[model samples]
Target: MFGDPIENPKGWPRVELDEVLDGIDSGKSPVCLSRPATPGEWGVLKLSAVTYGRYNASENKALPEGTAPGQNLEVRPGDLLFSRKNTYSLVGAVVLVRETPKRMLLPDLIFRLRLGEPQMLTASYLHQLLMYPSKRKEVRSLAGGAAGSMPNISKGRLLKLRVEVPPMSLQEEYARVVERLEQHRRLIGAQLHCLEAGLDSLQATAFSARL
Candidate 1:
């Protein structure tokens, strides 16, 4: 985990994405409302959903009425998502969806990554590996678009990228470390929220007393 991912220091077999997966899946992009979808409504995912490593279900637009949602492209928990088009820095952005809301569909700009039969790698480990600085640079190099336009990575070019695949046990071990770090981060976030709430309440009481 400390060395370059592409180096394959562990001596694992490095292969192109096409060899490891059947194919990448993408969705359609229909004209959608500017507002986010409410409960029970259909929505299309926004690029911001994968702009960062974190999955944000709220960064989506409500699908226009009369437009049938793409059931085949609906995102689900444990899915690995990738952005094919975006700013130079985010052209190859990737994210792992831990959980997702119902009735949500992916946009054409985003593709859902699926591992092939034999399940050579875990989703979490793969997601982390892709985000590694060295690997990201390689992924970004595959993007090509006219100047002044958004950089885009074609599915063909992306599939040609070769990556190292470690043993399942090693992948699971790294995933456990990631989960522990996430849990600690969540705990800190909750504590911050409580402290902020208390500060807000205190400020409101102080203002009221002065009135």
Candidate 2:
């Protein structure tokens, strides 16, 4: 039911993504075995790190020493990560890194983007845009191959994609509004979970009394 309220908003700058951001690069695949640290010494993240527009750090794998640096992609907080190859349904999946523990690395299949100007393109706003369904569909349309196993949208193509930008102040305001909504949603979810658990417990007690 959410509509484009920004389309008609005054004082918003309608700009392409390339105009506001830079350093749209993909990660490289490190060699299977190299010198640095073993598989256990380093934390390696794959496409699985991204789920429902959030980064699940717990799913990350630990790499031991001797793993080549080139095999893993280097990413930092504020970078946007996307899955380059996936089925049509899952292609163009995006996640924004809120924070990363020291020396975290991403897998080769993920693309990392660093915003050129924090003021121009707020990470929170861009993260919301990346999770937008329309944007995901647009990216998926650019997917190559008939099998749909490798729906690869190149960095150049991604750079060329257009995005509407609002003023920094407005973006920050919007982010705050979104954050409040998310908080409310989480609260409702928690209440639902508690009710469900209570019901289960009551059912178990009744069964025991009958026995």
Candidate 3:
């Protein structure tokens, strides 16, 4: 139901990213084991988890055995995550967490976006708006770093950047549509996976049987 973000046919009020935020919460980086977290183990979120516009809960490293979990840094359902530092092209990546595995915490390079006005700015809609190709371009321009290093955006710079905010009703509607489309995509992906598996099995049987 939404048009190209930059078009702003709805002509919603525009504001800086921080205008609707109480404050952004950043997590700390801690030494952790290389393996993905096993059930019952606490894990630190990897940057890949929030990259490419998808939240991959499996993309986390286990905390070293017995390391106290950072309770406050845990990723919550419905939290909108933002990558504030990364390679030039991926620095501004963002994702919305639908559900999360137990004990997964945010890392230093990522941010949990906290909305000051949840009534006005829903995480689902904000996630959709931020990932637009046009919006990515604007966000990337805010990143800065020295030569040969990853680009990063300071909270101050992000606060100064502008974004258009549609009315709450339209934003909520957009979120619902996006969720439905996402569900459809996942169903199709599952069907394709099943088909591919069946194909592989049939191919294996045929080749082994010399039919």
Candidate 4:
């Protein structure tokens, strides 16, 4: 639910984060009662599961036998996750969930964003914007708590955070750019793996010769 919408300039539209998001809710905080789970067991997500630009569902540990996985705790693909509480630097760390394996429930410390209008802003574009260095710095500065322990951004502050919203067309273009960049990244990663293997073989041959 958005507050009173702000009028935009002639060209670029600006909106508070709440304007574009339908809801922001954290998950159940069940006590960690068991070790990390196998592939099919019910599990609880950890704060570490939400990394910048990535999600590791495997970071979750198994729930105890009697713990109830609360309603609305399941994190589906395409959900945007934010760390509401963590060390100052890690607070507000966000990630796009690309996949969910088996039954994984969202943990209390992580908040999920429910988009109000997908057409107005693609998830990719908003994700890129949030992870932008300037925004990240702003988020870190806003987080509040004790000196050494977990800092937190209140839900009110998060909703009030302002964001620039360009035209939908421009946002789509940016999404395409992100897609291409990801493709390029995967290609480069494969090439680097090959190069590393080649180097390892060369080192092995050199060691054999010395022997």
Tell me how many clashing residue pairs each candidate has. 0, 14, 0, 0
For residue 119, what is the lDDT in candidate 2? 56
Candidate number achieving the greatest TM-score relative to the actual structure: 1
TM-score for all models, in order of appearance: 0.93, 0.71, 0.90, 0.79
Q: After superposition on all CA atoms, what RMSD does each candidate show versus the true structure?
A: 1.7, 5.5, 2.0, 5.0
lDDT: worst 10-residue window of model 1: 1-10
lDDT of 3: 0.87
TM-score of model number 1: 0.93
What is the TM-score (0 to 1) of candidate 2? 0.71
Give the alpha carbon lDDT tens digit for every residue of 1-211 in model 1: 5357867676778889988876799889999999999999999999999898789999999998899988999999988999999998888889998778999898999989899988788888889888988899999999999998999999999898988888789888888998899889889989999999999999998999953
Q: Which digits, one per residue and each the tens of the lDDT, describe model 3 over residues 1-211?
A: 5667778776778888778888889897799999999998999999999889999999999999778888999999888899999997898899998879989999999988888855568888888778889988888999999999899988888878787877788888877888899899889989999999999999998999866
Q: Which stretches of candidate 1 lie over 4 Å from their true place?
A: none
Error of 4 at 84 (Å): 0.8
| lDDT of model 2, residue 123 | 77
Model 3 C-alpha RMSD to native: 2.0
Write the residue-wise lDDT of candidate 4 on 15-58 in tens digits.
78888999998788778755786776778888889855578887
Best by lDDT: 1
lDDT of 2 by residue, 1-211 (tens): 2235244244355566677677766665554333333333666665667745777665555565565554335567667888877767787788877566655677767777768854587777877776677767776776776672567777777777776676678778987887788679779979999999999999998999963
Which has the better TM-score: candidate 3, or candidate 4?
3
Candidate 3 wrong stretches, greater than 4 Å: 1-10, 207-211
